[model samples]
Target: MTRAVVLVTGPDQLALWQPLLTGTERTSAAPVVLRRHDRRSLRGWAQRVEMFHKEDRLERLHELTGGWPLLVDQAHRLHTELDDPDEVLRRLAGLRTDLTRAREFADAAGVYADPLLAAGYRELDKEFADGSFDWENTVTAVALGGELEEDDAHRVIACLDALQVFDRDGVELRLEPLLRECVTLRT
Candidate 1:
């Protein structure tokens, strides 16, 4: 027997792959979700792109991106193309100080360009329109006083995860800092 491992990656895995797989195939498939890179993996990616010269700058990149691959790649591209990459990183890292600056950075990064992420953002924005959500709270709180069924809450959480809007540590879910800033600023 030949054994093969297939990896499926996209903004929405279910939407991308579900239609093609039969019910038994879907049930038998073992899915492994890939999360953001860590410092080590970030270093590896940076080295491959020949952007690993400055230790401090690399650390700053890690901090700013939280290992989010798209943001990291964007930062790397800006780093290579721009005369002063530090200034760019500095501005993005300091977005918390100015709402306008945050919006500009978010726009430049094409944060909502991905359809799945845009949909997730819209869902989150609609759910937490007041811009007051407790990150430490469970997904049940996302339902907002039982408005959504338990399955709906799970689906929402799954969608957010697929969009990389938040990081899940065991049972806890914390929104990505940069995304949180952008979302809150928009609200």
Candidate 2:
């Protein structure tokens, strides 16, 4: 008989699951280059995090995508799934009509909303420009992962006015399927 035990440690489990690049099994899962984080990395990350409250700069977030809106729309769709999936799908017909008529951003305004969202959107813009928008996972990684907080859910709606990346009418927002696939990698 065997029982499952939870192991708690400060090491990266992804790294632990495979051999290092310098180790024998080069064909194993890809190696994460972070041998150890220096104070600069730690401090820089800390600074960014602290600043997130003061000025998140998002470094992730985008409501409006310039061209090939497919990816952006898909991301919005994915975000909707994160919401009450039943409602999103069930009320989508009515919501689409109402959203198309609405003129306001979806959520309440917050202090760091625009900056944080811009950070996310700008990255998306860059990716789109670089032709990387075709990959959904990259967009999701930028928007939902890396210091992403549940609180961020509210802020995205709050900063809508300034973001202007989403549909003004609100009917077109969505997330791509590829991004959804990438989300599993995080867990």
Candidate 3:
């Protein structure tokens, strides 16, 4: 028997890929689903990262980037880029993950010509201003706030996911507190 394992990061990607594998499985005609890990898994990842990098800075990296595999990979690169953990973290903390990420997503999705994504992103920026951007309420908040529709919310969320602003889940969303600080900066 042949088996395939796919790593899906967010809802949009899942929607994109799930259709392709609808009936390819041998025994079962249903699509296979896998559960993602919780934040607790970060501890083990932190240890592994610490060992690999030979830097006792995974905890700090996790504090900044969270446990998402991609973010961890970025952290690893950042680890190689700088000698001091404090300087590395300062660089990370100074990033505008929101803006840069939005641009990347828009470019990737070929939506740079459209203002909808930018407008939706600004709505999210406003939402993150005084309080938190609730993952669960993201669509509703943006829709109700007249920034975007539910469908557009998915696109915006996809952008944010790519940027590591929010870790997307089916029913709930998790925010990386450190990056969230960058998103919600008042000044």
For each candidate, what TM-score against the reference?
0.63, 0.22, 0.48
Writing each residue's lDDT as its tens digit, candidate 2 over 1-187 gives 8555444322223234223322435553443332212223433543543321122221221212122123224434644455542333333223223433121112211112345553554444444432322323334544564345544433433232222333222333433222212222211
TM-score of 1: 0.63
True-vs-predicted CA distance for residue 40, candidate 1, Å: 2.4
Off by over 4 Å in 2: 1-114, 127-142, 161-163, 168-170, 174-187
- Tens digits of lDDT, candidate 3, 1-187: 8887655444335444333343223454343443222445666665666633334455555565545455555656876777565667666554446566534433433223235444555566566543554565777766767645576566555554544445554555555454444434422
RMSD of candidates 1 onward, in order: 5.6, 20.2, 6.9
Per-residue CA lDDT of model 1 for 41-115, tens digit only, reads 888887887774588888888788777666687777777778576776875476566777667655543335454
lDDT of each: 0.60, 0.32, 0.51
Residue pairs clashing, model 3:
none
Q: Where does model 3 exceed 4 Å of error?
A: 1-39, 51-58, 68-71, 78-115, 128-137, 147-164, 167-187
